[model samples]
Target: MRRVIGLVLLLLSVSLSAQALSWAYAFVVLDGRVYEVMDVAVLDDDLGEVVGEVKTMADDMDGSYYGDASNMYPIGTTYRKVNGEAIEDVLAVEDESGWKRAEYRHDAPFSMRDHLDKVAYGFVGLGLVVFVMYRFRRTR
Candidate 1:
């Protein structure tokens, strides 16, 4: 029983110690309101790197009805970590009163930068595999 409890504690600690993914923030001034974006990227910090992304509209009312027919609406921006490897996607949808709603997917690895790099390498490997297959097919 004691060993089980110790194992459980160790698992919990490992999960808790996982670093948070860092996100890049992009800001724009639109109609006197500041709109900020969150996307995957490397964040400079003492702990090395962090990754994740977010977009925020400040001091704005939260409602969908206010968006109006005009397309001056706030749309989510796309973010790619480690050049153009993994993409962190976000979308903005109109809510009850012209308010923009943020919907995000939180399934990517905690280290956006590192994971993105891995993605890059994976793509390279995939490309090589495709090339080899193509060459073999052509030879046959």
Candidate 2:
């Protein structure tokens, strides 16, 4: 019974972890400002040329949520569209660039921080506690 409970708990924990990662947002630093990314694009070099676009415009009511360009990715100075008040923040530009391909996001989760280190520390602390308890009970 104890083994079955532990296995079930482990499965539940792993599923919850996956859910958290799935909802993780990708951030983009634009002009020294960081924005939550709901989408990504791949653009051409210098002058911020559009190498792709969204064939069908997204229905964004609260604010704009679409663009007509693309970019390699964020970091080290890259050109990408963001949902904000900018003259260039339009669903479809006059020049028109189609979505080269579905812009998928592939970012390192918790990579920018010491989350892994903290988790490791937690495991080590837990192991030490369990060991101490076991040793005390055995001696008693």
lDDT of 2 at 7: 100
Candidate 1 lDDT, 35-88, residue by residue in tens: 333332232221111232224222233211111111233444322223332223
The TM-score that candidate 1 achieves is: 0.23
TM-score (all chains, Cα) for each model? 0.23, 0.22
**Backbone N/Cα/C clashes per model:** 24, 7
lDDT of 2 by residue, 1-140 (tens): 99999999999998776421222343332221223334433333212343233222222232122222122232232333323324123221212242111223332222312355568889999999999999999999
Task: Give the 10-residue window scoring lowest on summed lDDT in candidate 1.
Answer: 62-71
Q: Which prediction has the highest lDDT against the true structure? A: 1
* lDDT to native, each model: 0.38, 0.37
Global CA lDDT computed for model 2:
0.37
